[model samples]
Structure formats: C-alpha cells, structure tokens
Target: MPGGRPPSLRTVASWILTHPDALPEKERLKLKSVLAGCPELDALAEHVRSFGQMLTQLRGERLPEWIAAVRADDLPILHTFANGLERDLAAVTAGLSLPWSSGIVEDHVNRIKMIKRQIYGRAGFKLLRKRVLLAS
Candidate 1:
C-alpha cells in the first residue's frame, strides 16, 4: 500500500511455484498469509510443490500416482492437465524421467514455424529458403 503496484499474475504464480526458502522474507510472509486464508489455495500449493519435486528429482515413475492424487482433488484445472498428460502418458513419463530433452530441437522447429508465418504470402521457396538459412 505504500510504494508500488500489487504483484502481477506472473509474480504471484512464481511465488506459488517457487520454494519458500528461495523467496524474499517479505514475499514469503505474504504468501504464508494468503495460503492461510484459504484452505483450497493451501491444498493447491501442496500439490504444486509435490509436482515440482517430481520434476526436479526425475521421478517419472510416480506419474500415475501423481495423476491419481490430482484427480482425487476437487481442482478442475489440474484434473484437465492430468487428463491431457494421460493422452500421451508414455512421452510425458520419458520426458520427466530422462536426463535428455528435445527442447533444443523443439525450439528450432518453433523458430522455423514463426519465420514461415512471417513470409507466408510474400515469398517463394528460394527466398524462404534464403531467409530461413539466414535466420540461423
């Protein structure tokens, strides 16, 4: 109420996702009070923390158990997320557990898609190829 605007959605989401010890003292106290005021939010916090641990620890073998726990909660958004993960469960498990990732390849593919969109109606393959090559 004194110095700056309230925290933005991104900042709030980050606070919820980050480990408490990583947050500044002020932000940690604020988050503690907020979670204390709402039991549902408190439960959501626990679930998010558990999921974060699973990701960082490469415990993909716990995917099914995690999904089951999320589904047991009354959280519709997380339930939808769990359902989506179920659709490609094997890939999701592999991605979570493996030490390697296709992230770089995926980023390059995304870059090419953006470049194609930029030149879609304006260029022939020769020009497009030149631009794509130049993009690298």
Candidate 2:
C-alpha cells in the first residue's frame, strides 16, 4: 500500500454519487480533484457537464400555447398594446411606411428658425404651421 493516502477511490466515488445536488462550484471543484483519484466519475462527469447545454436546448423549444397564441394574434382589449407593437415594428423594419416615416416634416421644423429670421419674427404659430404643412 502507499505510505500516505486520502482514501480509497471508492470512498470518493461514494461521496460524489450520493449527493447530486451538493455540487456548488467550490465543492464541485474539490469533488472533481478527489474524483481524479478514480475513473468512476468519468461518465457521470460527462453527463453533468452536458446538463446545462441540454437545458439550453430544451429552453429553445417554443411552448405549445405560445405558438398557438402567436398564430391566433389574439390580445387583450388595449389600444396601447397594439400601438406599442406598431412602434416596435416601425423601429425594426426600415421598409415600414407611415405618416411619421418621411423626414420632410422634421426638415420643415428645423428650417423654421431660418424661415422666422427671414420674416423678422413676424410670423405667428398658425402661419408657421401652414408654411410647414405646405413645405412638406
């Protein structure tokens, strides 16, 4: 026998095999070091290492009701929810055309200062609004 020993490999195997949920990172590393004293954990270690990837793959699955609901397009009776969806879609798809999409109105607002200065600040809000609408 060796002059010094931690324990028989069987002892380390039993310690890990019996406490599946006790494997915190620190404890897990310690257990791994001890397990290196034997080959018993090879299969268990491989499976444990793959557990997170397995869970991630499972999580990628769409829930049945979620798929059905998306297909149905049914939503609560709230205009805000629909409006929010519209805004999100607008932000994503640059191809979306709406009253707000064109920059003509924005350009008109930015030009208002120069237009007002040219007019010596005599233009009122109504005149400015009319000029902006016509410019756009």
Scored by lDDT, the top model is 1
Model 2 misses residue 97 by how many Å?
37
Worst 10 residues of 1 by lDDT: 1-10
Model 1 misses residue 126 by how many Å? 0.8
Q: Look at candidate 1 and tell me the lDDT of residue 29.
A: 76
State each model's C-alpha RMSD to the native: 3.0, 19.7
70-128: candidate 1 lDDT, tens digit per residue: 88889999999999999999999998899998899999999989999999999789987
The candidate that wins on TM-score is: 1
Estimated TM-score for each candidate: 0.85, 0.23
**Model 1 misplaced stretches (Cα beyond 4 Å):** 1-11
Candidate 1 clash pair list = none
